[model samples]
Target: MGILKHYSGGLTREQFLFYEIRLVASLICENNSRDEIYNRIMQENLFQYPTERMIRSMTNICFKRIDSLASQMLMEHLANASTAVAKQINLYAIMRENGIVYDFMTDVIGEKMRTQQMDFSHKDINSFFDTLQEYYPAAADWSESTRAKLRQVLTRFLVECEYLDNVRSQALKPVFLFPELEEGIRQLSDETALCAFNCFC
Candidate 1:
């Protein structure tokens, strides 16, 4: 049985939305297949948290009648995002640069699940996540050589067209991964603030 199905009977729609919120938030830091991780997050957050089957049963009713409410989740999360993620909406730029990004990642994962009726092995699942690890160097402890290898992966992702434009832009920024946030942010600037200031003002 699907993991979400196991606990879905108990979760509220609000609670299930939280599951998705956490998945996206975590995905920004941890590079796994968003679709696979989303499924797991649903199972972990809604099914097992407060109770089982009850909230989920209620959610089914609410979602059936209020379709828009189902996707209002990202709004709730943006309300709670740290100043960091809210700094700039540059994910679109990255997605333009990268290709075949998240769309492919999710679709492939879904197809895999549909065929096997099970989630992937942890090792296999975490492989894509390593792609996002460089941004969180404290948690990642990645080597320069490792980063060189990862850049190749990133380049491949850019060549593929699955990721949305926003994700493609965000994927390459890794604002915190390159020692400090400010330094990394500077790297992404199209022109130096000083240079721009001198030109315009």
Candidate 2:
């Protein structure tokens, strides 16, 4: 991944896409339940232990944002997932599509927010790129176009309106990018998932 990956927009699409990967991994792991999931995550080849809390925060925060943004029909559909296992899958899939994150998830930005203050060079971006790249199976072969789509969706959520005030602890968020080519990203970038999404936001 190139340093500060750039897209058609100024948002942190790459950062949020990284978080979404964590979301999917967590869900897949969750399908197996906490102990099993934790073990899979603990495997040195798989999930890293240090950022596990951030994954949980992402999940926790995502649901809240979804609840706030989704409509009664969408909410009802989520309710229909019924089982924890099923709900987990539905949520995982939705985040995959919508690129929306909970306001509190921005807290992860705090740890690396000052990365700019340092006289960082292009090399520094690799550390975060490595963290993001490792979370997914190395064998997975996603093309550049597909990856751009993933980042594009994430950029929508990282925009201004999606942020949380956090009156209790005031802090701005961190954003990052990697420059690449894309065609008609706008054709794909929109907040509305359904008529309800149009009605709600």
Candidate 3:
């Protein structure tokens, strides 16, 4: 995944969609192709989103994120692991799929963890975007509303992964990667990205 020239806004619609992702992962483990999975979801209304358009949009994001791993072991873990482990695994998958998110986790959140800076605030997010716009000029074109929504989505993602105590507190929490999940991640041969979880190489 090269540096993404344009940040995807899909997360704003659904952040760390654990249940939806688990459903998709389960289907993937069953040897379903992308089209088959999408069709199955469409037929079953598995996501229970109440609108076909919403379901399609979410499935697109989930597939993009899951396919990025390309690891059957990880997909199995995502489908069967305990909720906490599954969330972490999904977060890792998101980082793999989305360069903007990966950069934020590593450069902002991970760096904060390394430096023992427990307090995270909107200011930090703004600063990160400022730096991001410098390198990825397309990011500079995002509307304030879009930027705000992205910030909300990113914050919720960290909270869901237990990296933050809550949105209000914005306090960093210690995240322990399950051994099984860690092994699954290592299998991808991208141990460097483990730093995003505060696991220094």
lDDT tens digits, residue span 29-107, model 1:
4545545544554576643546545444433432331221122332223234453332111221222122222222333
**Candidate 1 segments exceeding 4 Å error:** 1-25, 46-181, 192-201
CA lDDT for candidate 2: 0.33
Enumerate clash totals for all models, in the order shown.
Answer: 27, 6, 0
> Which 10 consecutive residues of model 3 have the lowest summed lDDT?
1-10
- Each model's TM-score, in the order given? 0.20, 0.25, 0.91
Error of 1 at 25 (Å): 4.3
lDDT per residue for candidate 3 within 50-131, as digits (tens), equals 8888888999889887888778888899999899888988988888887778889888988887888888899999999899
**Model 3 TM-score, 2 decimals:** 0.91
Q: Mind sharing the TM-score for model 2?
A: 0.25
- Candidate 2, residue 86: how far the Cα is off, in Å: 23
Each model's lDDT: 0.32, 0.33, 0.83
Q: After superposition, how far is residue 155 of candidate 2 from its true place, in Å?
A: 1.7
**Cα deviation in Å at residue 26, candidate 2?**
28
Best by lDDT: 3
